[model samples]
Target: MPTPELIPADQQLSWRAITDADLDGWEALLRRMAVEDKPDWIEQRADLEEVLAAKKNNPVLDTILGVDGEGTPRSFGRISANAGSNMVHVFGGVDPAWRRRGIGTAIHEWQVARARKRQADAGIPDGFIRAYVEESNPGHRALLESSGATVVRWFTEMTRDLAEDIPEVDLDPEFEIVAFSDDISESMRLAHNEAFQDHWGSEPRDEESWRFTVTHPEFRPDWSLAVIDKSSGEVAAYEISSYDPESKELVGFIEGYTELLGVRRAWRGRRLAPALLAEAMRRFKADGMEHAGLGVDTENPSGALGLYERMGYTPTRRSMAFEKVLS
Candidate 1:
């Protein structure tokens, strides 16, 4: 175990989970990070209240941060285990001046130990822990590695400058493209489950999951578009989009988050995904977006990375997944 260099009694700090009252500080830290590193354009915040409301109910979420001897928050970090599993994921950022003194490693140790406690309390068996580390920020990767994490796979964050004007698609005469309204929640859930069935670490998403998803503070229905089988009126492919009018000034980033884009196996190889994505891009640009973004696995079996590249989305940040099996 790595010992955190002592911060002297006057400076020794403790860690705390974020509370509703910490929103200001939390937002400040997030915005500050944005200024320091303009990450992918897809990261947005459409409805923060809804997100915080949902987060309040999450049993597997803990935003851990260190506080100074004076009780001021000096860092921000989070540990989240996917529901119904022992696979905890953690990420953190310490204040600039306080870094390089082992505080990050200490927080990482604290996060892992917390995950272990959560598993024990829930009677879950020991399993693997997973996390994503961005190549743009080597310091974070180093911190996680110092805590025994090993990079297992790399993923790419792709961005499409909607300003580039991807061509429009002439939807197949037999297909219908439409906004996924609230009433079609079930269809969205069904489509998402099927679309992601073959994806890495994917699991079936039911109604409960959909309920939580669309209502996330960041979910914007107007920005979301879907395609359906005109004959059966069943959802065929979908692409979700969002723009945080608040982040990065009033003119914000629009993200084409392909939450679940797929044509059922029966309808595969019809070029539905690219078609839907193109439509989504056009719609977002029309709504005053300056840029669009999406994340794709470089080695996805579906060749999604190639498709995004074809759409003019270049990789801006290289992120790797780290996993460790618990003994």
Candidate 2:
């Protein structure tokens, strides 16, 4: 791949690949960006570290940072493609203070170039690029739309107050809730894959992805709940959760986030989902969490949006996924 274009020589800003030594600078830059772009959001240093660590394991990932003359990161962008997949995901953000200077667009262009090079190396034809934009960010939405990107999918962040009354959802007599354990990891992964087989953009997770998810520092095993069928002793449904201390501290609200929730195909419509959701909410309430949150695809075939609404989860934010063709 050719070298990515840098800021003009006359300008004090320059572009460079992110390095391990830049973690502190990266975290600080992200915090400042969040404060300007999303005052309610919290950017955690450890989360950024975990992501960088994972990227280290991938041979085909690129992260670029736009730095000022003082060496502070003013913009960030990353392009990543899963092995054997023809689509790449690109994410980039510029410091609010640095907006209107074309930094965001430059970062995006660099990411797209890097992704195209990667697709070429992989022999992928008609490769695609995907980017996510929050509904609140008019600038990003305008930029993507004007760049010929179109919305292909939508997601909503939902939150339910644990302090409010939650209705009881009874599981079938044969199903019982249990704590997550390493022994059931394989079973859980298989169940998760099968459960989402019909969902849009669904893909079976590779071993590395599953391991990273299960062992991530923020994954709260105690908050992760699974339902088992007593008859077959098989996994029926699960809710994987994580606790965000930084978000809690910054937002002034303690919340447990359900990262993944799924039920086996045969287990659907058996009230297993509600049962699992209720259990997760109960656990969060017991742990003194003020709220529980989850993201849902608005078009989920399983009527997830309606189900979550019935469970007292209200939409807090909306995000749209956009795709652009990369020949």
Candidate 3:
């Protein structure tokens, strides 16, 4: 595959492959972009480092950075394609101060080209490139739309105030709620895969990716919970929680994020989801968290939006996933 020029000759910025050394500059640019574009979701240094350290990510081949004349990083883009998957995920951001200079468009073009090449190299016949942007950011949305990407799905960020009355959900007597731990981590992953099997755009996470998620720096096993079927000794439901200190600092409130929540298909009608969520809320309040937050697909087949609303979570922000079919 030919390398697409990340920076146009007419542009003043220079481009290069990103490395671990660029984490500081990259994190700064991302934080600034988040503050202006999506204050509620900010990536921290550790999160950036995780991207660089991912097992399947080759920074030199999959990532690029655009720097100004003075050598200050201003924009970046990266693409990831899971093994045996037909989807290539692209993510990047441009500094607010550098908008309208064609930096974002150039980076996005490069990303799309790289995604297509990756799909072709992998021999994927029916593949697509996916990216996400906050609905409030019209410029970003326009860039994606101009690139032939359309809004494939909408996701809502919901938050519940811990000060409000927490719901008490009753669980079946045959089930028991347990704190997340190493012993049941694999079981939880299996349950998650089975739970989301029918959900749109859902993919089963391999062991490596599942490990990366459960062991993330911000993951809080003590705050996370899992429901077990006492008779069958299987994971029935789970709520994986994480605390983003950076986001807390940015918003000036302690918020516990539910990174993942699911109930196995066989356990769907048992009200295990609401019970697990309510328990998580109780734990968050006990930990002095001001809010409990999670993101849900607006059109989730399981009526997740309605369930969350009934549990006191309201929409705080909306984001759109855009996709372009790979030829």
Candidate 4:
């Protein structure tokens, strides 16, 4: 590929993986361009660190930067290894002031090339990559689609308001809501594997991955809740949410996510999911959050959409996933 011209900025723009030293600039750029529903730039420091750590250690993950003519980074993107499968997650951001200048398209083109190069280094297939873009984020969706990626899944970031009375959900009397903990974490992990066991392209996760995801910077153990059978203490349902100040998540957008709401197989259709979600919303409301959010697979076997809808979660954004095979 010919060298990308330096951005119009006085200094020449260069592109490269974000290092710890680049956190300041990267976060600043993210804050300036990110739209609602995306993580705030300032708060992304830790998250980006996590992404970098994964890329640095996993060998399969990669990040690219686009600098201006003056050696200033104007945009960036990353690809995370999907150890559960051969696919990778492609993500990125561009300064709002710099849009329509081909910065986004440039970064995406670089991302695909980076993914291919990583595949060569790791000796893994140059598998197609996937990305999630909010249905409302037309600019980003256009960039990815124009890059030859295809939408494969439509996901929803749902919201449930806690100020409203908690809906009466029918759950077994034996099950009780419990705070998150190591014990509950294991059960939550197991439930995720089971609930998504047959979901398209689902992959098994180890304790290591679970540890990384669950303990993310946004994790607030106290906000997480698990439902268990009183006698056996077997986890039946659970809610995972993370904290984000209005600064991180623009106002009106859910500052906290109702991250994961999982129910055991035998407990399906028993109203466990809603009841658990209601309880979580109640908790989030008490914690002073105006709203809580969660994502749902449109084709969930457990009818997750109906459950979330019943809980008063409207569709805020339809996140679409796209893929293109690279072999």
Best by lDDT: 3
- Tell me each candidate's TM-score: 0.83, 0.92, 0.95, 0.85
> Against the correct fold, how does model 1 do in TM-score?
0.83
Ranking by lDDT: 3, 2, 4, 1
Question: In order, what lDDT does every prediction score?
Answer: 0.67, 0.81, 0.87, 0.70
Q: Which digits, one per residue and each the tens of the lDDT, describe model 2 over residues 264-310?
A: 98887789888888888888889889998889999887799999999
lDDT of 4 by residue, 1-327 (tens): 214442333324565666777777777777666553363224457776777665334422366676677666677877776653567778887777677777677667767776776666777864778887777678888888787788888877666665667677676777788889986788888878886677775676667777876888878788888888788878877778787665234636455677666667777767777777777767777777777677788877657788778778777657778887766
Q: Which number leads on TM-score?
A: 3
Candidate 3 lDDT over 1-327, as tens digits, reads 124454667767778888888888898898789778856767767678878878876788788898888888998999987787998899988899988888888888888778777778878888898888888899999999998899989999989999999999998899999999999999999999998889998899888888878878889999889999999999999999999876676655789989999998888889999998999999989988999999999989788999999999988889999999988
The C-alpha local distance difference test score for the whole of candidate 1 amounts to 0.67
Clashes of each: 1, 0, 0, 16
Question: What TM-score does candidate 3 get on C-alpha atoms?
Answer: 0.95
Q: Across residues 191-245, which tens digit of lDDT does each residue of candidate 1 receive?
A: 8788788888766765655776777666668767778888998888777665554
Q: Which stretches of candidate 4 lie over 4 Å from their true place?
A: 1-11, 35-43, 55-61, 69-71, 120-126, 247-256
